[model samples]
Target: MPSLSEVISCLSDYDPNALPVAQAQQIIRDVVTPVEAVEKVALRSALDRVLAHDIISPINVPQHDNSAMDGFAVRGADVGPDKAATLRIIATIHAGGGFDGEVQAGECVRIMTGAPMPQGCDTVVPQEFTQAAGEGEVTIPAGAVKTGDNRRLQGEDLKAGKPALAAGKILRPADLGLLASLGIAEVPVRRRLRVAFFSTGDELRSIGEPLDPGCVYDSNRYTLYGMLSRLGCEIIDMGVVKDDPATLSQAFRIACESADAVITSGGVSVGEADYTKQMMAELGDVTFWKIGMRPGRPMAFGKISSNGRNACLFGLPGNPVAVMVTFYFFARDALLRMMGAEENRLPLMRVASESPIRKKPGRTEYQRGIVATGADGVQRVRITGSQGSGILRSMSEANCIVVLHHDQDTVHAGDMVDVILFEGLV
Candidate 1:
């Protein structure tokens, strides 16, 4: 693994004080290493887990050539383009059943959906498209269906000995069904990432505790829990640690010793008197930075070692909104990488701005927004009132985040702005 400084040295324009958001993201990606341990999990328990190995199909999907719908199976040669043809219904074949005898010319088997195609039959004529001519016979009109119509070819969905799901894929509901179809009862997936997180401050208190004269409830840990839980991480909520040196040092050491990554939500901004910053610097090769982004400007990222065990550290800002923004933009991707999951960055959707937005160049801005579609079917986004970093309610009330990129200026009404939908992230 490359040291944090070594990775930063490779960048041509590395700036500790005013790092661009994208540049900081790239640096964190380059420094962290993925976990190597793998475990066999039941197919039902594999959802959202990263696949440690490629899943190979043992048998062809559908197993054999079958009917695609409830229709009659007939030879295409019997139905001509010029006129209708009547054929004798030799047998009725339902799903999971096949004809015992060969289907001769002018003899069509009545095949239902998912039924295997009988011998000497290729096309299927829908019962509605055909009329009963006489006893045990049906007529197919011209141009109703041609050769191979409604017939599911063997191995069309998936072929045997082929890659069904590639390595590094985060399994979903559909993936589970696919694996079950291939007779995969167990899957090799990367072990769930262990993440230890806590909030650091002298003025913060847990919910059950009585509020002191200058103390407020600690909401960062709960928010972190929700976000980390969505990522499927094995979370270790270490509660709130005081700003004292001994307590902060012990928390850092214990977190590094217990988890693959450690996250703290305070004492990272400039000119802070708290010991959280000092303890982080003394314990590891952590770098504090003033990121060029709104709602989340100050952050620290590096590796910390405790009793020979090391874990990646992410020290975020103290404000509730800043903590959430920094986690989603920075720590979220890093933890996903450590879990051996593929990089699946959230897509930025461009929509019209409902009103003018004040912005300055050289710094990126993440403003809470409410997006709705107009009666004309045009999607437009409006800011959710005030966008203060300390105001957590803005995040709760908004459905999306309007992202004004670095080097971009103010946005005029009706201008197309990039947005990250909360539905995709939360």
Candidate 2:
């Protein structure tokens, strides 16, 4: 008999500060999980990892101003429409060497891209623009010669002691080059978050097992495993546990002990055989159940005491697509919270609708849809087929979920709906 708001309120009251998704994020903003001190790891091992602490540049990127192009480093007074200056191409400054001699007026240095700028040289005319007419003589183009034309300013990438990356920031491929620019051979990164999930249903059987008259092959666990892997969680799958309370409790214990969070499919709804809810409450005060959302009416969240730590537990609905969607919207945020990720919500874009869709008030709906481009250069979306939770293929072929808020009852063509594109559809 608990309303959605009431359940959220109760959960807020249950924990000291952890509110539901709406407010929980705010409450946990400053509350970062324990960062396991900085561990210096080789740069090769730092890719696709989160920074454990802020990293400041020990040296200026590029070390010093250098030539941005292979050209003649010269003074602005050296080139003009009056006539070509007979400048001696003394020593070629090829990247590593510093031009020792001062570049006098009407003199230039042959420099390559990434070569350090000589002490007195300020401008560079590209080699193409300059023609070598004779020995120790090059043609300077008669054009608007601006001062500091091709100077690669020192600290252009980053200044010494500048914050190159902040703590808790997720690193990308390009970040490696930045780290290298800072001369960081090793990086301090946070430990990976551990997540364990399992599937539970009496009518479920493994793929290899013979299907019974009323049973179906278990797909929730495999799907969840793949999804969690993509989310960067260390997974420990407990396989398929039956509907029995003892078996479910044991499996939950295993997950709670070894994982940062425990996720289980099935046995979360208001069914007579449903035991996950009760077992969660018995194990370690499960805060609430039954969110006000379509395809995820039976979601439970809370903690389960196992070993020394209280691992977070999420009881997802049994439907394969429901499990996936609910996890993406609801549990994924929480798991990211545990991982100390700065951003919780995925990027959602507003896309116009090509067709209308049915809906009812009181629950938010995530209808699968195909997103296509319109002549107006905006993404237009339409529901692929049935908005049923069991339709997994519908979600597969679709590119995004056109999110319908709980307040909206119907959507018309050309109406704008918040669309969340599949993370890896490309």
Q: Estimate candidate 2's alpha-carbon lDDT, on a 0 to 1 scale.
A: 0.76
Off by over 4 Å in 2: 1-38, 80-86, 272-274, 374-378
Error of 1 at 410 (Å): 1.2
Query: Which TM-score value belongs to model 1?
Result: 0.98
Query: What is the TM-score of each predicted model, taking all chains together?
Result: 0.98, 0.89
Pairs with steric clashes in candidate 1: none
lDDT of 1 at 230: 94
Once model 2 is optimally superposed onto the true structure by TM-score, how far is the C-alpha of residue 247 displaced, in angstroms?
1.1
Question: Would you list the C-alpha lDDT of every candidate in the order shown?
Answer: 0.92, 0.76
Stretches > 4 Å off in candidate 1: 273-277
lDDT of 1: 0.92
Q: Write the per-residue lDDT of candidate 2 for residues 1-426, one digit (tens) a residue.
A: 222234446443544222233343332232224335456778878776778888898888878889998889998777776666667787688978877788887678899999999878888888888778689877785773567888899888889888999887777778888888777898887777888888888899998999989999998888888888776777898888887778877888888888878888887667633455566667785644555577776666666787676676777888988998878887777677666566747788998889888878766788898899878788799889887898888878988988887677888888888998996621
* lDDT value, residue 251 of candidate 2: 86
